[model samples]
Target: MLDTAQYRMAEGDTLPALLERYASAAKATEEAVAALPDLDVGVPLPRTPWSPPEPEVWSARRVLLHLIRETAQHAGHADLVRETLDGANTTAQR
Candidate 1:
């Protein structure tokens, strides 16, 4: 894990810079996942060297499922926020 302190953004940070950072990280993550061997998908994740240590690590498949679920959850939140700002209806009114 990275030192969280260094990644913190100041209050004056620009939106484009923050978005560029997100894009870079996302692209790197995608590339790393793509480079992994196909046979390792079901293997257990490596143990971390943390003090308390991780209770349970997830397999690649579980990680992928979690990513999918999280993305869906965030998308829902974004939709609500957008609707609130624009008064645009995302769903059919009953």
Candidate 2:
């Protein structure tokens, strides 16, 4: 895992710059995934302190599913925050 502290934005960094960086990274990831010939291909997992004790390999499909779930979780959290600030139901059906 990366040391996130090292990648923290500088004090002078603007919101637009930060958003643009995230957008670029997301596009790159999408392109890379699109190029993959087989989503079932598995790779040895990097053993970090947070990793399971047992050895593991993760297929590309599993990784993508995890990413999707995590993104949804974050979006939910953001919606909660937004609702707290203003009584708006962003996810409610129109």
Candidate 3:
């Protein structure tokens, strides 16, 4: 389980600051992924409550694909929220 306490927002946190941090982290991840010499390298998955019963290994390629999938999912969710707030359909044809 994640330590929610450690991830909680600070008292003065603002949306802009949070977005800036997210952008920086995303850029760093992109750079790191690009610099990886081999995508076939694998690592043992961490054992967690939600993880599979048997140990499994994930390759760098798999991890990258997972990250891309997750990011796209989150972006879609964010778009939904934005559309709800502004009554603008982001995906609608112009």
Which candidate comes out best when scored by TM-score?
Answer: 2
- How high is each candidate's TM-score? 0.65, 0.72, 0.70
Q: After superposition, how far is residue 77 of candidate 2 from its true place, in Å?
A: 0.0
Order of candidate numbers by TM-score, starting with the best: 2, 3, 1
Q: Give the per-residue lDDT digits (tens) of candidate 2, residues 1-94.
A: 5455545778889999998988998999799789888999886676665678898999989988988999899899998999999987857586
lDDT of each: 0.74, 0.83, 0.84
RMSD of 3: 2.9
lDDT of 3 by residue, 1-94 (tens): 6445545788999999998999999999789778888899886776665677798999989988998899899899999999889998846595
Candidate 3 has what TM-score?
0.70
The RMSD of every model to the true structure, in order and in angstroms, is 4.4, 3.2, 2.9
Go through the candidates in order and give the clash count of each.
0, 0, 0
